[model samples]
Target: MNEKSGSLIDSLERQGVSRRTFMKYCATLASLMALPPAVGRAFAEALAKATRPSVIWLSFQECTGCTESLTRSHTPTLESLIFDSISLDYHHTLQAAAGTAAEAAREAAMKLNWGKYLLVVDGSVPMKDGGVYSTIAGVSNHDMLMDTVKGAAAVVAVGTCAAFGGLPKAQPNPTGAVAISDLVKDKPVVNVSGCPPIPVVMTGVLAHFLAFGSLPELDKLGRPLAFYGETIHDRCYRRPFYDQGKFAKTFDDEGARQGWCLFELGCKGPVTYNSCATVKWNDGTSFPIESGHGCLGCSEPDFWDAGGFYRALSLPANPLHVAATAVEVGAVVGVGVALANRAGKSAAKAGHETATLADLEK
Candidate 1:
C-alpha cells in the first residue's frame, strides 16, 4: 500500500471515531451487504487494520446529480467520512488542484496504486463523433475512462447515467451514450441505478468493498439486492387503499383528500424497484406517495421513457379484487332486503297479517 492510502486510515482514527464506533460502522456495513453477524466483527477488524484503498472518481456526460446526492448523506455523516477510509486520489469536482497540476496528481495516483485502486464513475460515455462531446483536460472522456479503469480492483458505476446511460441514452439518443458496463467488461461493475441513488446506498457499497475486499451480492440487474429487492408498491403505505379499490381519480378528488391509492393517477409503484417507500427521503420525513403524489418510478431503468406520468397501467387479473368487489356489493344488497323484510314484519305485528279491507268494513 502507498503512503496516501495508509494515511487515510490514520486520519479516520484521528477523527474521533472510537473503536466501538468503527465496530458499529462495520455492523451497519454488514447489514447493508446482507452478510451474517459474524462477518460484521471480521469486517470491523479488517477495516481498522487494513490500509485504505485508492479511489479514482471519473465524470463524463452528466449533470453531477450523483455527486450531489453522495455529499448530502446526513446520518453518521457517512458521505463526508468516506474520504477518511479511502485515498480519494482524483475527483475533478472535489480536488483542490487545477489544470496541469490536477491531471498530474491523477496520473501519479494511478501509477502508484496500479491494480490496487478502486474506480468510481458517474455519467454515460458518448460514442458518437469519436467521443468528442465530453473531454477532460483535452483528453476524451472515453480514453480517460479506459486508461483509468485498466487494472481497477473493482468499478462502481454510480447513478443511472453510468449504470444504464440515464436520460442521455433515452429516446432518439443522439449522442450514442453508453453505460460504464458497456466499456469496462473485464472488471466487476456494480450498478447503483437511480436518477441519483440514495446517499446511504452509495456509502454502504463502498463500506462493503472496504470490509470484505469484494463486491456485495447483486440482483439480476446488478443492483444491491438489500436495497432493490422489492418493488415500491409492495412496501407503500397506500397499498391498503389499492386493495379496497379506493382510488384518486384526479389530483383534487375526495379520494385524493382521503389519501387513497394513486394507481388511477398513474402510479408505477407496482413495477418500480427501490427502497424509497421504506427508507424514504429527507430523513424519512416523506416519500412521493406519502405526500399524496403517485410514485414516479425513478429507480427503474429508463423511467423517464416509461410513458406518461399520469397514464395508468392495466391492473393484473387477481382474485383479491374480485373478492373485495363481491363483498361490497353483497353488503349493499343485504341492506335493501333487510328493509323490505322489516316493513312486512311491522305490518303483521300490527294485526294486518290476516285482515283485508272488506273484513274490516264488515
Candidate 2:
C-alpha cells in the first residue's frame, strides 16, 4: 500500500481493526454492489485517502426503530465498525453532551462542514398546525431539519418514517407527517425505506457514498438500485414452489410445514423490491420467507396502509391463468422442472450418440 493507504490502515488499526480485515470488508462490499475486483481495490484506496465526512443524525416523529436496525447490522464485529469509522458530529441518542451544549455542537459542525457533510435523518416531519407535532431543543423538527439540510452535501433518510412518513402518515394522519423528500427539495436524498431498513443496506449505502464520493444511482423511489433493483420474488428460494402452484393456505397448513410458497398467505414478495431474499438477516441465516413467513412489503411506499398482511393477491381472470395459491404454483413449477430435466438428459444422450457415429465414420 502507498503512503495514503498506509495512513488509512493506521487509522483502522487505531480503531482496533486490522489492515487485512479492512481489505476483506472492501472486497465484500464490492461483491455485494456487483463491482469488479479492481473496483474493490479502488474502494480501499478511496477510503484510505478521503477525509472522514461529518454526519449529523436527526430524529423526529419516530419509534427509534431505524437506529435500532443500524445498531444491529451484522458486520464482522458486534459493534458497528462502519458507523464508528465515520465522524458522527451529532446524534441525540449517542452524543455525550446535553441540552444547549449538544445543540451548540450541532450548529458548529453544520457551519464548519457546510456543503461538505452528510445529513442522516430518521422519522417523519409533521407539517400540520405549523409543525408543532414534534420539537427538538425548543425548535420544531421541521425547522431543525431544514436548517441542518440546507448546507449538507447529501441526505439519507434512514427509515420508512423519514422516507415515506411510515406509521405516522397512516390514514387520517392527524399530524400531517411528511417524508424528508417532501421537505428538503434542494439536496440529493437517498431513502433507505423499510419499517426499519436492513442494517447491511443502511451501511452499504454509506460505504458506497464513502467510496465513490457520490450517492449510488437510485430508482424512482430514491432507493439504491443495487439493493432494491429486483423484487424479492425474483430471487426467492421458494420461487419454484410459486411457479408450480404449490402454496400454504394458512399459518399451519401442510404446505406451510413443507415450506411451500406463501403467495396465498398474503406474501407481497412479488411486488416488494429488496435484497432480503439474497443478503438476508442475522449474517445471511434467513429471511422472512426462509422462516416460513410471508413478506409484508415493508420497503414500499405506504406499506402500513396496504391492507391485510394475509390477504391473497388477485390473479388474472382466465381459467388457464395460474391461481395465486401456493399449491397450484408449486405444481406448475414441478412440471417445468420435470421438462427441463428431461431436456437436459436428452441433450446428453444426443451428444453421446453423436460421438459414437463420428468414431464409426472415422
How close is every model to the real structure, measured as TM-score? 0.80, 0.84
lDDT of model 1 at position 252: 76
Candidate 1 lowest-lDDT run of ten: 315-324
**Candidate 1 lDDT by residue in tens digits, 142-243:** 999999988688899999889888888887888889999999989999998888887767777887777667787888878888888887788989888877
Estimate, for each residue in 1-362, the C-alpha lDDT of model 2 and write its tens digit.
54554344555677788777888877887777777899889987777666667899999999988888787644555237767767888999889998999999999999999998999999999999999989998899999999899889999999888998988998789999999999899999999998778887777788788778889879999999988998888899999987777877556769989999887666778778888998888777899999988888888877776665654433222111122443344455444433443454566577763221112211
| Whole-model alpha-carbon lDDT for candidate 1 | 0.75
Tell me, by lDDT, which candidate is best.
2
Candidate 1 RMSD computed on C-alpha atoms after optimal superposition onto the true structure:
13.6
What TM-score should be assigned to candidate 2?
0.84
Candidate 2: stretches off by over 4 Å? 1-8, 73-79, 315-362
